[model samples]
Target: MKIQVLSSLALVLALLSQGCVSSKKYKDLEASYTQLQEKSRELNQKYQSGQQDLSGSSSRVKSLEEQIASEKANVAALQAALDKCLNSSSQGNVNISKLVDEINTSNKYIQHLVNTKNKSDSLNVVLTNNLTRSLSREEMRDVDVQVLKGVVYISLSDNMLYKSGSYEISDVAGQTLAKIAKIIKDYQGYDVLIEGNTDNVPISQTNIRNNWDLSALRASSVVQALQNTYSVDPKRLTAGGRGEYNPVAGNDSEAGKMKNRRTQIIITPKLDQFMDLIGKAPEKATKAE
Candidate 1:
């Protein structure tokens, strides 16, 4: 009976040992499961953070693309402006060159006219014939005339037009002026300048003060005769006076003084083309004298 009780105690001890081992194993499994759950939470947090970072990166990339397109458009606009500037500059140069050529051609024509006057002896007979036929009978008179630099200058001496220091136009001079007006009217494009020259002798008349006044009045009187009597265009006419300043001969001799007292009517070709050329050239500032 004592042997049987010992065996039963041994069996109970074995069973108790197995139960303790099973409890220890279950605690170990629970700890392992908690660790796995913690690892899963960390992974999920990392994935969400990564998604946020990727979204921010995508927005930055789109903004950079827009900026690049804007810059390209700006570059294209600048290039177009540059091209337009170049074309305008080139056209301007071409226009300037063409204008210069026109001026050169006009200058040559003017020079030809000047050279024709230098051979006046051969041309005088023809010119006088033309003038006599073109003018009225009363305008025919023996007057001293000169041709220089394409200009026909008739010296209406004091004896022909007025008494000494007088501003009155003589009866004969009036007839001659009428004829000249008719000829000038026929030539529409000619630019006319009436210049009066006076002797060196000073005058103190009531109507006139000095040589300047006398010269100016004479020029004005002639211009008025052309304008009022002949109906010449005012725009095509200019009047100037040289008071003993532009003398033809020395003032010492009586004959020289007589030659110096004169009036000149200058006629020239239109200079519109020449003036256009001058305007197109670069501006040169002139200092005050």
Candidate 2:
């Protein structure tokens, strides 16, 4: 665009020197310049948007790591203090009031963790209900939406997501994922894991080494769709394969094998809020605040 603009200006200067510029040619140059500017703006905007997403993801992961470190430090400090309290008591030099206060503080910290866990659990319930309401009866038949251990799991049959021995997502699965993406965007702080599961059947596909390769590829395919097509955060998304293991049912029966061959999308909200409280528990400044 700059080259084109410079070339246009040079042409105009040359024409002006020769006193032979035409109104039509000048107007054409102006229109071309306008279009170039618009294109440049659009490209710049896209570049900035991509940078923002990258920055946001990196910062979030970094913050989570810091919180984990802080939480560990807090836990260690609490343990040391508790041990000191016990030692003092054993020596018959106990301060009953201080001990009681410390025990009460420990109980409060434990309750805080429990409350945060309950909040995640409640979120799973809401997510499950929302998924139940979103999927149609036919769609539900192809997938099972459940909440377990504060995570939302959406299990889809391999047949729905791919052809026999293939890792590509089918059109039906793509549509279902699109719907899921809408729900994902509406929520926040979720770490999603796409796990591909396979049955005990041996694979003869030359491209795929074994069930492991096929399953991992399938999980990766879904992750790509969610990240590229649906704009899910790359940092929050994980892809994995559980090949011929962790089956929901027995592999001896065809029905059971069919159930085993599936993709499960698990969404768990980040425990950052809880971690923050725990991380500051041993801090004097935090206590004062």
Identify the leading candidate in terms of lDDT.
2
User: How high is the CA lDDT of each candidate model?
Assistant: 0.61, 0.74
Clashing pairs in 2: none
Residue 54 of model 1: what lDDT? 51
Q: List RMSD in Å for every model shown.
A: 47.6, 16.7
Residue 92 Cα positional deviation in candidate 1, in Å, after optimal superposition: 25
In candidate 1, what residue range of length 10 has the lowest lDDT sum? 280-289
Candidate 1: tens digits of C-alpha lDDT, residues 1-289: 3344455455546656777546665555556555666676667656754564454345534544554465455545555554565567555666655555544444443343233333432343334334445544233343444444334455566667765567666666777777677766766756778888888999789878899988878888888888987898888888888889999899999989888888877765456733542343222211100
Best by TM-score: 2
Candidates' TM-scores?
0.49, 0.63
- Estimate, for each residue in 71-125, the C-alpha lDDT of model 2 and write its tens digit: 5566567667767767674634455456556555655554455555556656666
Q: Would you give me the overall lDDT of model 1? A: 0.61
Candidate 2 residue spans exceeding 4 A from truth:
1-95, 271-289
